[model samples]
Target: MSAEKWTPDHLQSAENRSLHLEQRRMQLLPVVDDLRRLAREMAAVVKEIDGIEGDIPGQAWMRARHVTKPLFKAADDIEQAIGDLGAFNTRYQRSYEELPQKRAEKRRRKALAKSGQPEAIESAPAGSGSPKKDEFEDVFDGLRQGA
Candidate 1:
């Protein structure tokens, strides 16, 4: 089932999943910060290595440059990863905050369905009927409304 589809029967599981997302986001935040710091440190080291002078042999300097090339690239990759992780964490946090409203909305919809009321469809925006979401989509599915 889609993660956001939290009916009354699966409310506990929904809450647990939301808590898990919060925990995972918290855990990743530190790692992202560490990676960002490490990347900056690595870049500084690379800069220091590139600035070395002291009669170093031509071949040795070339090898040093070669090794530092990958170090720079690694730092860049780490920065990209940190950005992606931070963005994901932001999204997770938003989803966690919105879970209660989503749960209430789902419950309301289910109650309407059970009562065979047409207000459910009428209450929804015109041409905005809910569509099935992919299981692997981001947690913001609840807010997307099939967009």
Candidate 2:
């Protein structure tokens, strides 16, 4: 019997599914970015209100109240958006993980037909170099020494 050959259709299906998930992930990224920006703006507004409280005596109280309401509302919206982004991220991660598995399965099927033996799994080897330190650690260490 002739050796069975793997077809393009299986690979194409996996590629299509991966592309679809990627598209969904891309769509959510902009919304997440916008929410993050809004959150930062709200934080800035809170700081501005705090600064104004010390400068302006009577009117600052009323203005702070008004500013706080909207800031809280914006914060709420940011929280919801962050939750949505987290869910989207989970789905994106799952799709990303599946894509590699599908590709590996296709390769295994081809190998089984050609070699008539179980396919061997390959993985990246561990690093040989020393571990790297985070950038913030150096700055914090300097601050601690100065203090």
Top TM-score model: 1
Q: Write one digit per residue (lDDT tens) for candidate 2, span 29-109.
A: 576567567756765665565544346555655655665566456646655665664565466556766778878877776
Per-candidate TM equals 0.37, 0.30
Q: What is the lDDT of residue 74 in candidate 1?
A: 62
lDDT string, candidate 1, 1-147, tens digits: 444653444423545555545555566667656755765675556546544456555754465566556645664675566567557546654676677788888788778978999877666546685656764477776678966
lDDT (0 to 1) per candidate? 0.61, 0.57
Over the full model, what C-alpha lDDT does candidate 1 score relative to the true structure? 0.61
Worst 10 residues of 2 by lDDT: 1-10
| Over 4 Å off, model 1 | 1-65, 124-147
lDDT of model 1, residue 28: 60
* Candidate 2 regions with alpha-carbon error over 4 angstroms: 1-12, 51-147
